[model samples]
Target: MDLYRNIPRKDKLLSLFNDDYAKTILNYAIDQELSNLRKLIADNKIHKIDEQLLIKNIDKRYNELISGSLKRVVNATGIVLHTNLGRAPLSEDFIHNIKDIVSRYSNLEYDLEKGVRGERYHHVVEYLKIITNCEDALVVNNNAAAVFLINNTFNKGKKVIISRGELVEIGGSFRIPEVIANSGAILKEVGTTNKTKISDYENAIDEDTTMIIKIHKSNYAIIGFTDEVPYREIPKIAQKFGLLSYCDLGSGSIIPGIGCNEPTLSEIYNYGYDLVSCSGDKLFGSVQAGIIIGKKKLIEKLKKNQLLRMLRVDKITLSLLQETLKAYLTDSYNNIRSVNLLGTPLTDLLKKAKKLKRILNRHLSDYFDFETKEITSYTGGGSCPMHEIKSYAVICKSKKIDINKIENFLRKYHIPVIIRLVDNKIVLDVRTIFEDEFVLIKDALVWATNQLS
Candidate 1:
């Protein structure tokens, strides 16, 4: 009758698990499971405890404790640069090629030519300069860090004139005004939120104004009688007054005709901005980095800033970014996974979807119906909000089982299949799903059907 005594001892429960897990972890799982069982007994939720059920619960707990939160999942949502799914997915082949360099020590900072300590930013700066046609370049942890470094370096304790319409907030509550304030630069907002002209920036500039920054509204668009000074015009205003000019091309792009009216890096540079910064992981399609490219003298000054050390990236990031830049320089767009996905032709996507549908139907015909559907995909990660890419998705429907249940099962599977439900149907957009991941999707479908059946 006493349910407390029904709980097994720690050692007995621990013996059920293997030595693959640490003793402490095993003990913790057992203790937590037993504690839960005790709570259930206290709540009078059950008359008695089942030994098998208790063992099963402990086993589940042990697995949960040992499992890592960062597991690879199939990105079936069709968002090429899904921020939640780790902005940009690096190429496995590329990572494999650079494994020796990243895994082992190889002159990350040592200058092989001069046989002396060298700058880490030097590795990718040349490539960036060539690709972007900039005088110099620097890489920090992310775009926000690049912006922070620029603010702290030049505009700290000075006024930074920016258009109110361009004051943008990106993912994770990263607001422009907050970043400037945190960097010790005073923010001077000019013009209305929906409309700001060149005069707004000109009037806001004073002796205290050290710089004028034009930020790209990457995530959203302002419509209906909107007037803002073009980025190209800012440098002229700054030149006339002998002040610094910078533009935050949030989710900056190098590839022209990438759509969504996103200006290329070269175009921005030609506009005569003194400094420019963008995200490496977004439209750039590399590792996560804040890429700052501008005049050589200004870049040198940024390198000397003490905060650069804190914002600097590791060798792995540099290596990945360098490889991505090489791909761009050589016109090897296929090597860049994000670029390839974004540029995948509609015909190719339809073929991929058809192949995937055949594979799924061959295995899972009884429980579900599979068909290809044309859908819209986005260049997510705040790069282009209005632009939509034509994509193909495998729509799955079931009559015997609830559609939501199937979706939940796929999501909770060992290898989660991140999917979307469209009008009570499961949608798997093949735009973001790699060909190699087809097997995983098939397996996930099989696993879901088996569990649901």
Candidate 2:
């Protein structure tokens, strides 16, 4: 048939997707072929072009493009927890545990006590309760989910009072108001954007006020002539109205230091937030999950909520979070890659950058200008939005090579290296890049030199 003639003689494409799968590919392939066929008809080359050959060629191209890996260029760009680069890199130990749990039959919901069905969240529940010193705890897929679960459980059909300044729009336009609305909680603005006081909440109090929520401005800071309420003062206010005080500590930090006055989960609970929700990924440096920790009475109510089971984390998340919490409990801060990077000293980072520069210069000395300079690295992924840590970078100037082109090529390479540009020169910040990635950077520089010359 004329249509059969358009199929190309490519065995690779033929074998890759068999009849059923190939049929799906063929529809789009044929649509693409239709455009080419139209051109052939217009050029009077319809008879010269084999119809089957055309289909096969298009299918070959389609097959080549369809792969499982979600490959994309990462211009690390000096953002430490670059959210696009999968936020924090999973620690080696965490990665191993993930593989072991995911690959086999885990005790995700199988209770060994009576050989009965178990709860998936039980994996991290005890750890969170112990570490945070909370009476009970729960976890979900992400912080947003945790917030929703808490609100739906406690504050539904009631008012959730929050400072206007604290109502932030998280990454991807996930605004605080929107989340509260979705959770069936009415967002009652308490005070001015930058200056909210205790009186604001006191005046806004009403019978419908089910909870007084304090949303931590974790990602950013409101400074200069700013007056805010503290956790210590909040419990009294909530107690006055018999309202549950919940704190959504987005990007909650466990490790202290670096000037952010944000309290840890334990601190918040101690200071008197009845319930607190934080992210597992951001400051905790674990997988993408939401951790809700608070009083047992409230948590037990949340646990009994049907929506809790719907938004509960899977076995893999449970396992990774459980192990990640253990690392926190043991004070093995190094086990969490993001926390470790944040805690590294400026002197140590400069020394490492100097070492990386020396290794790279040994290979590309003649090709590029190499110099180590002091820079500031961010605790990105919306963790420490306003804080900047002093860091060092090996700034390289490529001779006659297009800076953008060089950057594009480097980004396209396997296991891409993210670099920054200073004064039109390519700069690699060693703060975010670990010691092991140093050799990889050196190799990439060598490859870039080859591309230039």
Candidate 3:
């Protein structure tokens, strides 16, 4: 029989699509099952139909479909602010703080004192002001929204003079020029790519210029003979022309130890910036959001602007951000996960690596090469581009299964183990991995070795 003739039609495969099979996997689309069954029929013959195997395949497909693609993976990359694995995992205790808040209704927008509607940002603004010493503060969905609000609220159809060197591309391909242009503002880039002076900004200012903006190159660094004006210098020039001054601290820095040289929010405010914007998920170690703090008048303009309504944060985001901010006011070292993870001392990491080595070497020694070595982790999420987090990694390699095979096998485990492969070796950075999760790592490696053998 011809190959196409052997393939079953929908009506022909009705037995499998009946009440038991179809209803069992109602969560998953049957179309995929049809495609796979048809291919199987074509590969074999009509007489070779495997009902039991088909049902087994259906069960596997159903499990994959029900468990959404975004399954939680263990971050062994050692990057504290890993962008892919949900940058800055909130501390379990901090999440517990907001569980009751999210479980029931609270005064999100209602003012209990006067029996009137209150502002959503009122939840975090006072805390933000207290921390940064800003006159006023507001919260948006993310830092990009804060940047867009600045441009849309103040510089619509007007010019925003910025240094060419400071024109940065944030994560997910969102560029500075694109954000400004999309916000209904004009981008008047000044200075050269490697050099921009206070005079460069001063020279670009004209009657059309509404603000002088500076963007932190959060993800990249340029060294050797590069000249840039102080963050304070740009706003000083803007003040001379009666213009607003804003700085988008891309991966918002509140802690000094996380990203080595990134300026703190308080330090940036002290530098005379009229408005400062930051992301909550980055170094703030909270939810994904933009925090804007500045003079009361400027913030009021953003709050009252119609654009704010479009870019405003929801109740849950506001609540989570409020709790995350509370972490900073208290003991940030104990509260924030990224702060503790990134700030994990080299001595501590060495201790962890030794402990991991003892566990893994006992089980994985036969199948793989196990050695403890000093490794470098990054401050990911485009915060500290090439800066290294000195740490220790259990460097693993197998003679039977290559690094690619090891990586693929580890991913198939119940809790996916994400490891970094550098220098033709499988590196498991133990900084981000919890001590409790070590059992899963052991099981995965054992299973992988058995399968390969």
Residue-by-residue lDDT tens digits, candidate 2, 1-453: 364355444454445555655566665665676677767766766566564576567766566456425664333355657777777666888878689779988888899998999877778888887777888888888988988888888788889899888999887888989988999989899799889999999999888888888887767888898999987788889988888888887777776663245577788888878898888887778888888888888888988989977788888888788778899899888888878877778799889879988898888787788888888767778777788777788888877777887876687556677777768899887777777777887787678657766
TM-score of 2: 0.86
Give the clash count for each candidate.
1, 14, 3
Model 3 Cα lDDT, one tens digit per residue, 1-453: 454554455454445555655454543445577676677666664555555665566667767876768888888898888888999888788778888888999898989899999877789988998889999999888888899989999999999998888888876788989989999999999999999888888788889989988888888887888999888787788888999899988778887756577889888998889999998898878899988989999989888899888888887798888888888888666678888888888888888888888888898887777888988878888788788878888888776777788789888887889888887788889889878877778888888777777
In model 3, which range of ten residues has the least summed lDDT?
5-14
The lDDT per prediction is 0.89, 0.78, 0.83
Candidate 2 segments whose C-alpha is farther than 4 A from its true place: 1-67, 71-76, 258-261
Each candidate's TM vs. the true structure? 0.94, 0.86, 0.93
Ranking by lDDT: 1, 3, 2
Which candidate achieves the best lDDT against the true structure?
1
Return the candidate ranking by TM-score, descending. Answer: 1, 3, 2
- Residue 50 deviation, candidate 1, in Å? 4.5
